[model samples]
Target: MDAGLLAWGRAVKRRGGKIPPLWYFTDAARLADPLPVIRRLPRGLCGVVFRHDTAPGRLALGRRIAALCRERRLYLVVAGDARLAATLHAGLHLRGGRRGVLRLPCLVTASVHNAVELARARRAGAMLLFISPVNATKSHAGAQVLGAAGWRRLARLAPRGHRAALGGIDGRSIRALGQGCAAAGAIEAFYFNV
Candidate 1:
């Protein structure tokens, strides 16, 4: 496990919330396998969001990943696949283009980029949200970065730290960012350097 990821997991356990504070986003394009990192995480220490959308074998892969998550007691959210999520008894993570919540059996989360998207999530009854590009990210290089101050403002509009800080957050940036979220997540942060 990355020291930062471990520390983030410990932080989540320290907090008196049911939601874990650390997350690892699986991007097939960026990472070969997340299981190695997931294995290092203490059971129930973090959640995994499998986001290789449009992969031909997504359902099969989701089932396999879901089994692993169940074994480790990790919360698993299938991005853009409410049906699959529901079938596996896992949570659902709405894609960025989908602005509102859909009636589903499991927890509903949304990807929020700006204040406008935040407002939509607030109204749509999402249980969680991920506000992204908090800093420059390899996935979306040169994209708009939401500095700490801006992130704080956006977080306030959400469900009070029920959201997460995605993008470039790692150990150094996380310490600098402070307690703005119930959780912090990233692809690079967990897979490699920030």
Candidate 2:
């Protein structure tokens, strides 16, 4: 078990109502071996969000990831592909603008730019929401940035128990955010790597 998952597991044990921390790896190209990454995570980490556009032969890779996830007791979500989402038994994440048919009973998540989009994601059956670009991000150049204060304010209106702040998020920033969340008991789950 890695440090992140150990901390998260202890936190969950301490606070039964809180959700586990998550690590959203939006940079698919940078990921060399997804299985090792998943296995390194402790059994307690909530899940990993793998975002990639649907392509030929992608399902085979996704299925392999999903199978590894199951063995490790970690949830795997295929971001932005409803067909892959439906095929995978773990979770599904959709962007605010994408339109796709979702199969039932899998965990549903979405990215929201604002309250309106958040609402729309909820109506679409998203149980988790990733509100991104909370800070200026090199990966997503020219994207709108929502700082910590904005995240706090927006988090107030989220309907689901799970909401993660994305974009420009790094170790130092996450530490600070975790402290703030810890103080207010606002965020139960945190996703990151040390």
Candidate 3:
């Protein structure tokens, strides 16, 4: 993990509350085994978005991750699975354009790639929005990048203290983003050298 990126993640926060500045987003293909990485994350004010959507035995894997988060005091959000999240008593992370309504009382987050998605997430009652493609990323190689300016534009549309920078976010890029984002989420940044 880059010390600069970690520092940036730790320092950025909303005015009213301290959202976990650093978010570890798990990928089934890239980060098959996330336990070791999760263990290495700095405790407190850090979050894990477990996104093993199609992997076999995902529920079992989520349970393990959830256990680690509890032990390490890391916030855990199971992506795309309300039942599993509820079972583990963890938060929920919705994918692109998904509605976020849930009866369970948990931290609800969503991914937004454009203005429409951003508006939808807010209406669905997502507490945080992970704005993506801030820069070119291997995960979405050909995807259009938001760059610094575009990201700021979309982030500005989000509710204050509820926007998180995602996609190709690293120490250098995040520094460029300044205070536009309340938090930052990454899959490769935390697992591999970026």
Candidate 4:
């Protein structure tokens, strides 16, 4: 974690409120080694969603990340890997429209790109939803993005109230969300030393 990020996390952690809905999604392509960043992140201020299931030795790495999360008082969610989620007693992350049920002790969250996906995630009992492309992003280069106004419209569709705006979201974009639009979740910006 960058010193600024750690300071930000620690400052936010001191709020003594509900866990911040902000999340950090891990991507191997974004950062070859994310452990240092993960280890340095502020606990209780951000959730870490491990999503490198296809990478070599992913299971072992996931286990290690889960353990680090536990030790640092950070919540971990295993993306698209129910078995790992279960084994680590962590939350499960599902892609948009990926249907699944989680047993007790495991919370469920999903990524949504539109109102339909938002509705699907809500109906699927997702406690939190990650809605993306608040601005142009590298991952989906040249793709249509949901600007602030569009995001606000789609945000109304989230009944569960725990949603984060991701994808090319910078400080300015977050301010543009206005009041109650959503929280901020990031991948490259949050974890890749960008």
lDDT of 4 by residue, 80-130 (tens): 777778888888887884755555366787888988898887887777777
Candidate 1 local lDDT, 93-169, one digit each (tens):
77662632346766667778898887776666666778887888888888998888778778888777576788888
For model 3, name the residue pairs that clash: none
lDDT for 112 in candidate 4 is 87
The 0-to-1 C-alpha lDDT of every candidate, in the order given, reads: 0.74, 0.60, 0.84, 0.73
Residue 98 displacement (Å), model 4: 1.8
Q: Rank the candidates by lDDT, best first.
A: 3, 1, 4, 2
Candidate 1's C-alpha runs over 4 A off are: 97-102, 192-194
| RMSD, every candidate, angstroms | 2.5, 4.8, 2.0, 2.8
Q: Which ranges in model 2 have alpha carbons more than 4 Å from their true place?
A: 1-13, 17-19, 54-56, 97-99, 178-194
Candidate 1: TM-score?
0.89
Model 4 CA deviation exceeding 4 Å by range: 1-17, 101-104, 192-194
Quality of model 1 by C-alpha lDDT: 0.74
Candidate 2: global Cα-lDDT? Answer: 0.60
The local lDDT score (0 to 100) that residue 37 gets in candidate 2 is: 57
| Colliding pairs, model 2 | 21-190, 22-190, 22-191, 134-146
What TM-score, over all chains together, does every model reach?
0.89, 0.77, 0.93, 0.86
Badly placed stretches (over 4 Å) of model 3 are 13-16, 192-194
Per-residue lDDT, model 2, residue 157, is: 73
Which has the greatest TM-score? 3
Worst lDDT 10-window in candidate 3: 10-19
